[model samples]
Target: MTTGTIREIDSASVDADGMLSRTMRILGCFTADEPELSASRLGALTGLSSSTLHRILAQMLDLGLLSRTPGRRYAVGVRLWELGELSPLALRLRETALPYMTRLYEATGENVHLAVLDAPAPERATALYVGRLTGRGSIPTLSRMGGRQPLHTTGVGKALLAMQSGDWIDRFLAQPLERETMYSITEPDAIRMEIDRARARGYATTREEMTLGNVSVAAPVGSIAGLPPAALGVVTRIDGADTRRLGALVTQTAADLGRALRAL
Candidate 1:
């Protein structure tokens, strides 16, 4: 027996053009709304033939990149989640911020969130939530762990935006902001004013901007080594909510978490 290079067997389904790109295309088809997809649906979404789709799905399943579900549908595998947990944002930042976020939740009985800036460019920045805690008594929120939200419409988002450089902020505000609700501040100058207030007050506030009946108070966590800018915030029902008090609490918690991360 002699060692030899291995290659794919002759198959019309095999695509040699862009292995990485095609894999990403398949994975990207699964979203927060639809986590599991069947081969037919994936073929339609990716424009790949059934044979090619089935071949790639089989390879991904064996590698633990995807797993099969009932009715032959496939989902993101647990191995991907295990790898995500190894990221510094997860192991260090999210784990470190969990205790402080829990304290905020207990003190206010509201939805507490920890998020980091996901800015490839000034205009493309978003708040990427890393951790969230909510109680049964807490009002429902559109945010979830690992979800992205607009920086101009959410408290934690504005807080993160306030930490950017003046030039960066200028570029960020140059684009027209999307209006999430009637109360969402879409005017660039108005959002700039809110960012100014957040900078001066050590926290930011959003009153029914992201959702109709909720108010959020958030504060930025000062710089941490090897980590993107982060913020923590609380969301509660707007009625009878004391944003002032919540602001004070959020400010303190964010500061404390920043100190803890630096010490580590």
Candidate 2:
């Protein structure tokens, strides 16, 4: 079907849910690209009447979901971020892994990351970054707390995907994967091979895949017999460092974090 047709169906479905869906749509319109929006812009984007938009915006403001800026534009409030932080899986994983992540950063003087699988979607699997620790003067990274990245392009994403069932991995690999850098592996077979390597070695490594100058090593954070809730990774610049050795270190950290998570 055409994109317009799909959007119409989505709109109809949202309309079926009445005010709750409308409120959600309004909130959804604010994204990383457009963090702040005026009421008229919100009305235009959501296709809601100006009166209805204002009414909903006012309610959202009162409920602490949206805040009005000094410029009279609206942005997502800290209250909403706090509510997102309350997700049991993300919360517990972040809490359990932060100390280990910090230790990894301190030991390596790099960027340490903790990420969990985002909720399943029909199109593709993605990882939601839940925690991060950057050592002083560490290489800059695009990942941040609460950011999402594709499962096929990141070391942590590959590590998490490596632990999934074979059929699930096959289905996930069938999706169109984005090539974030020249070195990114776009072929499903290549990605599957990488997953296999991660499973055999108990860790994953990506060499300039997600970012041009960044190399990452990651390990899954869970029991050997169960699906992992998250992955732990460290990123560094590609400068002839021993990535295999780094992988081993990250694997040990992941194992420690996995034990802690199991205890929780």
Each model's C-alpha lDDT?
A: 0.87, 0.80
lDDT of 2 by residue, 82-104 (tens): 78777665467777677898889
TM-score of each: 0.92, 0.90
What tens-digit string does per-residue lDDT give for candidate 1 at 1-264? Answer: 000001112223446676655666787777678889988899998898888888888888898889989998999887777887898989999999989999999899999999999886788788988899998999999998878899999999999989998899889889888899999998878988999999999999999999999999999999988999999999999999998899999999999999999999
- The residue ranges of model 2 lying beyond 4 angstroms of the native Cα positions read 1-17, 223-228
Which 10 successive residues of model 1 have the least lDDT summed?
1-10
Please report the candidate that would top TM-score against the real structure: 1
Score candidate 2 by TM-score against the native: 0.90
Error of 1 at 219 (Å): 0.3
lDDT of 2: 0.80
Model 1 residue 50 CA deviation in Å: 2.2
